[model samples]
Target: MPLIPMKQTVTRIRTEGNEWDGTKTEIRTPMKCAINEGTKLVRSMSGSAGVQGTTSSEAVSSAQIYFDKLADIRLTDVLEYTNELGITRRYPPLTIEIKRLNGKPILTVVSV
Candidate 1:
């Protein structure tokens, strides 16, 4: 039997600059290492089953719950950063989806 692998979808947030004529253009820049690392970790472990008796559906459900909690934790961290730096910064919450494939669980985030 083949074990199904998990999938991850991530959004790229970039700053666009507008010229004098009001034309917008994308600026190519490297993403933060922390963000990239976090995304990779979330993708790799999202579909992991905790115990042997757990079913694929259960694994998917667990993954969804884990992602939700992670989102809340991220929000708290952002709030703390804003408070400490006295600067207003907005971070988008991750959108995640979990499903079963070939008797295994899969996790994915919807692209925005």
Candidate 2:
């Protein structure tokens, strides 16, 4: 039997905002659960009777599994208003960043 090595995993989420001026804003999220690198294995077996030479065969197999924990939101409402100058525009998309602290998400940065 052979012992397999374990691997570390990292997760990140980022949000960005765009202004009419063409400037970009960014937010970075914290690392959540470490990614899990599954496993791999190979096995083979063969049998023969009254054979002049031994026969052999080989086979390979592998397995991998992981869990994803992330928060998501969707916008369902829109409110618009026109100023005295008669300029009208729709709302911008919301941006969010998640961070981890003490093995949990503690900070949430939001921008529009």
Candidate 3:
């Protein structure tokens, strides 16, 4: 059992195609799941190039979600987050990092 309860609703299984006006397909099914949302962190990356001294920086927030042991998900999967505060947000995970914690699968996602 996990120490934290997965009460947040996770909507997965996004479709990406449509032909109505310009596209060729559309997604109609969502894989609803209950996952425990935890932790928030800011990740930043900076780069500098050449003698010209050009620089660039990128930053984004990341979050972790705990799912049942052996839960199936892919890195390319798009997830919609609906929290207890009644805020719903949808974004495709930047990168997925999975670990086994307390016998549960801990999935971490970063927003880009």
- Using lDDT as the measure, which candidate wins? 3
TM-score of 3: 0.47
Better of 1 and 2 by lDDT: 2
Candidate 3 wrongly placed segments (more than 4 Å) = 1-3, 16-60, 100-112
lDDT of each: 0.29, 0.34, 0.53
- Give the total clashing residue pairs for model 2: 1
TM-score of each: 0.18, 0.24, 0.47
Which regions of candidate 2 deviate over 4 angstroms? 1-11, 38-70, 73-112
lDDT of 3 by residue, 8-89 (tens): 5566654555556676543434433445444454444545453443244444444555554445556666677767788776
Lowest summed lDDT window (length 10), candidate 3: 25-34
* Best first by lDDT, ranked: 3, 2, 1
lDDT for residue 39 in candidate 3, whole number 0-100? 48
TM-score winner, 1 or 3? 3
- Candidate 2, after superposition: displacement of residue 41 in Å? 16
